[model samples]
Target chain A: MESGNLRCGRRLITSETGRGEVVKIEGRISFLGEVNPKEGKLYDGRSIKGKVLIAEGAKGSTVGAYVIYALKYYGNQPLAIIFEEETDPIVVSGCVMAGITHGDMFGKLDLRDGDVVDVWEEDGKLCLGISKTPP
Target chain B: MHLTREEERMLKGEYGEAMRIAMEIVVKVGEVLGADKLVDISHAHASGVSYGTIGEPGLHWLRELSSKGAKARVYSTVNPIGMDLDDPNKIPVGEQFYKKQMEVLQAFKDMGFEISVTCTPYYLRKPKPFERLSWGESSAVAFANSVLGSFTNREGGPLAVASAITGKTYHAGLQVLENRRTTHLIVHPELDDPVEWSALGYLVGEKVGSGIPRYPKPPQDEESMKLMLAASAASGGIALSVLEKVTPRGTYDIGDEERVEIDEKEIEELFRFNDPELIFHGCPHSNLNELKKINEIIKDKVSREFWIATSPKVFDEALREGIIQSLENKGIKVVKGTCSVVTPIERLGYKRIMTTSAKTYFYLNRKGLEVALVRVRDLWRVVT
Candidate 1:
């Protein structure tokens, strides 16, 4: 299990934050091409529905922002998003518009796929708790 | 971040619900990008109009905004849709899909957006030097910054829409003068054709990614420059490139920039391709001259399908000048307001395609289509 202070540009869009299993993708994702918003399934056959989707950042089309919106519209959005590198405007704008909670990994924590993670905001600071056991 | 009195009023919802929503999005994105304040913008262009790309959720989102009485405060233009709005039956899309596409289009129109439907807005109205703009569509951002001497970040569709409504964007990224400085100087081997220029841009974009590159010599022709900028934006997310003498003076500083040179052998690798089932042009929407050049190339009818995509304005001009008829007489299909990159070519049963635009090749390859890069001059010979 691993834990770290949450890092992001601004405050979380949603107030309610909870725990979920982490689904880590190694590369940058183009939501338009690499994701199916209707099903919330990635091109690799893994599901992002109700999980903390971790990735390097977004790539490809600017239409990617709307894909994230579609994910929420279909009730298949991720529990949260955790990215490493600079968050492109497409992802950031999409998360804001959809009212999804997202933060940055900040290269401080080593996370693995299937790791159970909990996130919350405290004293104007975002905190994360990681555990091996399923929440 | 500091906000003006009027900006605060808008954020506080003194300005309608649409303005409040737009202000929230702008300020949120501004904070994320570390923008200190908002800057006024003269124009905004919104992308993500294609039904094939955005699907039902995007359609609903636009309709929702229209219902909320969202209207553009500044002059705004829209990107290409999934099919031609004027003549939808000409495209092979289903009637239901066309209706959905029209719904999205109508919503944008209701929001006071001009139906330009072009990736290259510079073709319609060129921006002056150092003019602030809020533009989506990656290729247009690159072109506007590098070619038209405008200041704009590579905006997302939602951000551009927000800017259209609010008439402002965050003062960050390429909108800041210090951020637009050339960091790398790339010396390239001489290129004669538009395809070669596009290939060079594609290679450089992949090498530099988001970094600005300074080219010793830029393509002189409008088509080649357009292709170069489009390819770079497609391949590497490059928002701007500084051309030696072409880019306006005092706009970018290239002092002591790290220099690199690209040889001819490297560019030769990009031109290798197999025979193509279809030929496509206008990833960034063809200019009138490109349409004329294509019309001259296909003098006689050929066997394979040749498609030329252009904006509605260009298409109308071409139609009036008999360029469309000449191409159509040669069995070429000229489409308006959409291109192969944004549309789903699978519906047309086209698995393999060849194009001169590296931007088109890069995008279609990601969409699981077989794309071959070929020179525009060599297209007729190879395809036939």
Candidate 2:
């Protein structure tokens, strides 16, 4: 019903889009990466080793279902996803599956890949103001 | 909002307390989506009971809101749950998890639900393609709306069940045949093989999130539908593409239609060149026939170490038939429950995975899934 003068970026960590509130933030070793709206890949094809990251929703989980647990255990994926929606099923499902702490009310970043994002909390609401981003 | 005489009675609580409660929840959903009136859908589908997210106060809140175990009189269906609780299978999960889940599912079954645990219920139990049926599988929702021409609103996990039980839904966007119309103009198949189908679906879905799409004709097969539907769910939330002549209703079943254009780049990312970690199949959960074909294609693969994924039900069936066990003896993992994109492969400390399945290809890359990549059907050649 209400939106501000926003420069919408194609990433999950910014508030200019559907799940703009930076609810939770994670660091390197993030798995079950949120399905990024920008990158379009469910995996986003990024090197999260030490990069400040962003993501959409969660992926998949369940202990013994047998699709990819062994692969992740050996792969060493350590990155975090930004909560764009209430509970992005992809990121949540992935975190649950990977046994990682997927955050929702934790970090701040007005992301657009290379954008110098201005994210903050206003009262109880989260807001993002982007100053720059990658083309 | 004019209510039918029966609807008015239910609103006044003249109907049994249970029906009244169910209607209340339906009404809320209707209001949220800005529906004018409620309509009757003959069939429905739901997410079913499983470990809900750590986010929501668990699914118990949803359970409490509606009659969880209430019998769904409508010809209803459901998605797969979190692994079997009481199974004595070879790779059975913990008994506690099993017992706990069985209790949850039993409540629903007690309420008059059937326990078929597949995603594309339309396949296992054929619904006349275009007939309006309520379903919750995101993949199935789009598939139903677009491909099958069956009517649905992409109803969420619990709401889908509520709609089934009460025999009525809030009648939002799914109620009328007008807003239910497709806007996407033409979808040209960019990928000739199944591998490209994943990215193609992702591309289309991302462009038309929560929007309607009309396409040339879906791949006239189940595997193709699965690949496209999975990416559709991944790219956005849900999309009900107007499946042209193939749609259940088509000209005979469709209303007036319009067209919207899509970006080619959107469809390409799914096959975006990335190191592979694993090959995935059965986005809507592979059914038996599909698995049988996949098993046949992989029987003599030289890859001592690789991962193949499907539902536990299929895996168990494959195991009982000695298909998977033989492959396991050959060091292949025909596993279930976990997807390559979400598995904590780094935790187990292995590196790299290779898989085919556009759904997996897109998802794994986002979470930084490690490894190599291969086309899904190529692995099928192994058993072939």
Candidate 3:
């Protein structure tokens, strides 16, 4: 469980890279009901705007794709998203439509909230380089 | 993953920008979901049309796609919007909402979609057995996969739109024959009531999550089956279920499956008798039989507010048969092209809603309305 470098199963999107503090959510998110797009906050008041948002994966409403699009519309969107499990159709459609940097299959990554990381693509695969700074 | 020469051309942007983007989305989703290749789909149905649910951002996205010349390559349909198009003011949204809703419809129409504005597209054109499809609207997806024996995953709204533009979807999930097998068995008590069927579906869906459940003996009537299927999709992510007699044989098979029995008590707990300010039926939109049944029950004028929602085509037939006038004479408002669950019914100032469909029960409750699941037989008593 080293934190230096980790690889994902696939790089869903590789056109852009994201470098920001991690915002770790413990469970799956149903973007429609759990997120407040206008403020870019979760129901618990954690702001994902410009942060590297990570979660188990998506669940609940498929309308979540539109909610994610709304996040971009309101200028309250995450810089990137990472899923610990295989991404669901809701997340795939949302990230595709919203042009968000996302990857899946990092079920064993040793990461935490407030940690800094650089998410980029190398060899057509997703790479997460964890920063040395302690949170 | 394997791709045909045509699919490779699509991914390589041989098509327009809209088609390219749509193909990319579908391909990426397929890769993640373990799809080996893309398959041609006969039809596609897109959801997320409701302005209330999707908001301005969704409208903007639709406009962008349409402006880029994205069109449906196959026969396509859409889900319900936020308002009743036949009577715009009935749902009680602002002028801004009406304008935005129209723009949403125009975008879909521009994409060559039928703009049917219904979750029950099976009524518009029933899918044949083993037809490949990419459809949104969870309830409709359930009906297509579980009841009609068609092949489709429960696709998200945007993904379905993408599939419509590309005329293809990744071969995965329920589309594969082996994936259609039942992993669990659902046992329930004998119940003739539609509400009881709804409650059973909710219970089973909540218990089974996304796993396919086989019902040994399901209700024979179409309305009751519709209620059950819709309820399951609403409560859980059940795309396909195996109904012993109802589901087309050979479409699904049972393996070593876990058995889950419905407690009669749980079904009873789902039923509530609280007086609601408005009573609504037809979450999936009422069929002709449902309309006639409602017409026969409420002989006297309604003592409280009552509304029946149906598709535009059904409404037209009901109008021709004088069912509309008969229900209207009894103070029942027959809403078309929209239902309470999709529209902004909560904003109309109703504190509680009484419905017979578990699908309606789940959605109306989510809308912050106090929803009560009442038996269909007792609907007349509640209305009075």
Best prediction by DockQ: 3
Please compute the TM-score of chain B alone for each predicted structure, in the order given: 0.97, 0.79, 0.98
Candidate 1 off by > 4 Å? A1-12, A18-35, A41-48, A52-60, A84-86, A105-107, A110-118, A129-135, B382-384
Question: What iRMS does model 2 reach?
Answer: 11.4
Winning candidate number (lDDT): 3
Candidate 1 vs candidate 2: the DockQ winner is: 1
Each model's lDDT comes to: 0.84, 0.52, 0.87
Instruction: Write the residue-wise lDDT of candidate 1 on A1-135 in tens digits.
Output: 335434433244553488888888887878887989888899888999999888887777777889899999998899887777667777878887777877654453467778888867766655567755676
Model 3: CA > 4 A from native: A1-9, A132-135
Best by TM-score: 3
> What does candidate 3's lDDT look like per residue over B1-116, in tens digits?
89999899988888888988899889988988889999999999998888888888998998898999999999999988888876777767889989989999999999999979
On TM-score, the stronger of 2 and 3 is 3
Instruction: Give each prediction's DockQ, rounded to 2 decimals.
Output: 0.64, 0.03, 0.78
Worst 10 residues of 3 chain B by lDDT: B84-93
- Candidate 1 matches the true fold with a TM-score of 0.91
Full ranking by DockQ: 3, 1, 2
True-contact fraction in model 1 equals 0.72
Give lDDT tens digits, candidate 2, residues A1-135. 112433322222212222222222343323323323123223545433312235443334322111112223444333333454333332333333333333343333344544433444344344445443421
